[model samples]
Target: MQNKIESLYKETLKIRLFEENLIKLFSDGKITGTTHTCIGQESNAVGIASLLKKDDCILSNHRCHGHFLAHTNQYVGLLKEILGEEDGVCSGIGGSQHLFYQKIFYSNGILGGNMPMATGLSFANKMKKNNKLVCLFIGDGSFGEGNIYESLNFISVFKLPILIVVEDNGIAQTTETKNTIANKIEKITASFKIETSILNYPDAYDIYTKSKKIINKARKGYAQIIVIKSARIGPHSKGDDTRSIKQLNLIKKKDPLIKIKKKIKSKEKIKKINLDVINEINKIFNFKSQSYSNRKVSLQNKKNLILIDNPLKTFDGKRFGELINHFFHIIAKKNKKILFFGEDIVDPYGGAFKITKNLKNLYKNQVFSTPISESTIVGMSSGLAIEGYRPIVEIMFGDFLSLAFDQILNNLSKFYYMYNQSITLPLIIRTPMGGGRGYGPTHSQSLEKFFYGMHGINIYSLNPFFPLEKIYEEAFQNINPNLIIENKIQYNFILDDLNNSKYKSLNTKNDIKNFITNMSLSNYEDDCRTIICHGGASSAVINFAYDDFIETENSSRIIILSKLNTLNIEEIKKNISDKGPIIITEESYKSFGLGSEIITTLIEDEKFKGRNYMRISSKEGVIPSSKSKEEDFLLSAKTINKKVYNND
Candidate 1:
């Protein structure tokens, strides 16, 4: 008991002294970005850290210095991170607010943002049947966030092994929590049927003792919450103190460090521990000064970075929607690790478009119907993927994908690079795109172009030649986050071979073709125009202009692209004839769209420098609900025919 108490005191003191030094450093202009100090609330983090096993995962909020210290105990590395040195934890890309270390510990600046990630980690734990728990630490300020509630509801329904620790310090930067929070934490969590506990004291030992039982329950498939009533002695960050002097004084009186010091009784031991902590901190400064010059070269080396390249597979014929369902059924049967999550994706409803019809009934344990929480759906799936499960999440529409953009951008796309590529996130985000459905501006949008250049993420579109089942198989095997863009208009189209004497197919059944790049030539004697299209636009162009290419004396070529990002520009350049005018068509907007990228690539190449290029895309406006207007809004073969024959 004495040893445990002494260790708790040491941990709390280390966090306190680390922050105190950081406060001085920030004042001295040594640290760059704003730092959220957890000076008075050290017990909350320390208490949670006590019950955590080495393999247990933890996600933290903006005020995360203490949590990082508690889990890692690498003061020097953390100090370097806050100082933004190249030798820092995340290679200086993630500053004090964002820190990822040891693969299991992650901290972000966004409030309540990591909740879904924690829930995902727990979901992974549940799927693997691993007796491990995921702990999430958030401030009272995060209670108002809708994602937190969504995460809580998910955790409750799934019965995931997760522990949520809310450190209620009564204040959020400058505003009181009571003013912002609608209902009490206990009552709100209880409504979800989650087991909740509130710790009103500010003592480390007290916290440690109370948290063990809750954590144990959590590890055994019980999602629980522990609200620690803490006080903030320091301001939220440097130069941001709004609390009165009296309030600060009262907070200092109940400081966890002070309360723990009273129990120690050995002044000599306390003095020695404080001296050791100071020396440890001093070592950080010495190391920082010595390694400052070499840090940049070390960062540039880029160790542990992973690259994904998967080959495309060919399928003969099938309807787009039915093919997708068949692909899902095959992958679900083959890989037990593949889990499907989406809205209305059960047996009867079979997703918004019936792409996942009967998947839930077949794979009862693996397939699940998620609530209308797009952010949580993506975030939690990311967590599940991180823990070695292949999670395929479906967004009802491409437009709603914006709601989950933060998780897709920050967590899913960046986790591999941010963590030095030590982790593989095998997550597939499948959503239907395009504007021919007459569902109006919000529902019918060809938004795949918006996510084109995201680092560490792969994007694919369904094409007529490539097998959808094989695409899913290759996606699962590659171990990267993939975005499969399904066009709404192509859902009912019959995918079959385009056999013509003039046009030669670039892809063969057994040949090694680029994942999504397919090309065919139209033998015309005079014209040398090359048409590049993808997804819905490809179907439109083929339907409208197939006969024009065969009959005309002017020969042209069509290139079908399914993979938008990491395109094979060299391969694409090889197919085009010398000095041919290129026309790139897309269902998305013209500005900053896929067509723009293709044009830029063509212009940059020395071979295609003098070639005439044009882009055929939808006008930069919303797609109306009327069927006729929607048809006019999207790029079609008639537009291509006019561009080619009439030169309109």
Candidate 2:
């Protein structure tokens, strides 16, 4: 018993000394980004962390230095990481907040964002039946975020094996916790029907003993929350403290190190332990290390998805939704890592646009209906992907994607690179976007333009004219996040309607995968025009080209690009081989959209420098619902003609 107290104090003091060194480094401007250190609250990190097995996952928030050191003890790596050194853990990409260490430890700076992700990690462990639990450290300030509650609801409902450690330090950064939260943190957690415990003492042994019991309970399929009422002795980051002098004095008295030190009688042993910890920390500073960057992550316990070379012959007048279902089945058969998540994406209801219809029936263990919490649903994808499950989530409508924007931007886009290429996110968000259906203003908008230049992910626009199976097949191999935008009105259209119907055009294979060109049957005359568009505007552009050719004997080359953000300049130029007037059309508004990007790039190309290019877009005011102005909102044959001929 005496040895345990001394040992715990030694570990806790190691963290304290390490954090003190980091503060010195930050003061010297050696650290690149902001940092949050757990000074007085080290006991919570050490106590709960001591109970965790090596395989048990640990995720932390901004104030994570103690939690990270307590679990991994990679002091030098943590210091180098904060210094932005290439040889550091996460290759210096994630810095102090966003971190991943061999899949055992993960952290992010976002206050409430990590909640759902850690829930996903627990879910993955449950699926694998690995008997492993995940511990997530969150501050009291996290209660202010809605997604935290969403994550709590998820873990509790699923009976996931997760231990949420709340380091309730009385104050949230500068503001007192009482001023922000209406109800007590325990009451809110209890509302979710989760088992909750609270402790106000800083005894490391006491915390470790209690945490072990609760963690065992969690592993047996019970979600738990341990609230450690601790104190913050240091500034939130670097010199940001606004606490009163009395408050600071009081916090010092509650310091776990100080409390536990009083229990030790041998002053020499305590002094030796503290000196040894500092020496170990100092030696790690000189340790040589190599850099680890983004590399191809192997599929977890599953063979890589192989692409069959057989030509797709099934697009013989099949419904768009059925074709989507067929494609999803093919993906499911090829990749075991693929899991489907969305609201009402079960057997009978399928999905909002019937894209996932009968998917659950086909892949019973892979399909799940998520709560209407978009952020948490997306956050789950982030965690599952990092843990080696490629989750395909449906966003019901593209408009609601805004609700999960933080997750998409911060979690999905940042995880791969931030973790120094240690992980791959085969996370795909498939959603229907467009204004053709009268679903109202909120549901009928194309928001893909908003995510155009996000570095780590690719966006694909599904066209009825293109093969659906081929797109998913390519996306599966990419091993990154893919946002597929499907046009709602085209869901009922016959597959390959471009060649089978009255639209008689030539299909030219392009360099980019699934990106094709439809050339008018008329000869490529000198006066031909080039039309750049996607699925939503493909039919309208083709019909307009047919009539324009008939009237003026001028043929049109229509380039339909599925890869929205990643434009192949050379392939695009090949399709626009003839020096003709260029026209870009989009179902979305014109300003700062895909059409603008296309036109802007086309004009910059040396081959089309002197060319006349115009962009046709839907009416701005009619977006979302605008039922009375549906014609104006949709990019139709009339809308295209008015924009093309009116100016000419």
TM-score of each: 0.90, 0.94
Worst 10 residues of 2 by lDDT: 289-298
lDDT of 1 by residue, 1-648 (tens): 767888898889888888888899899987788898998998888978988998788899888889888987766777777777677777677778787876668887778777888888888888788798888998888888888989999999888899988898888999999999988888889999999999985578888887788889999999889988898889888879988888889888889888888888789888888888788767766664644321222222322222222221333336667767776776677678789999889979999899899898889998999989999999888788777688899999999999888888877787766654456776899999888778999998888877888877788888655555555655665545898898887888764333543223232221125654444433332346777788888777665545665566455566777677667787777656564688889888788887789889888878778778888888779888899988777787777776666567
Per lDDT, the best of the predicted structures is 2
TM-score of 1: 0.90
lDDT of 2 by residue, 516-559 (tens): 65565454444367888886777688778777767786667788
Off by over 4 Å in 2: 285-303, 308-317, 496-501, 507-514, 523-527, 550-552, 622-628
- The lDDT values for all models are 0.78, 0.80
Task: List all candidate RMSDs to the true structure.
Answer: 4.0, 2.7
- How far out, in Å, is residue 70 in model 2? 1.2
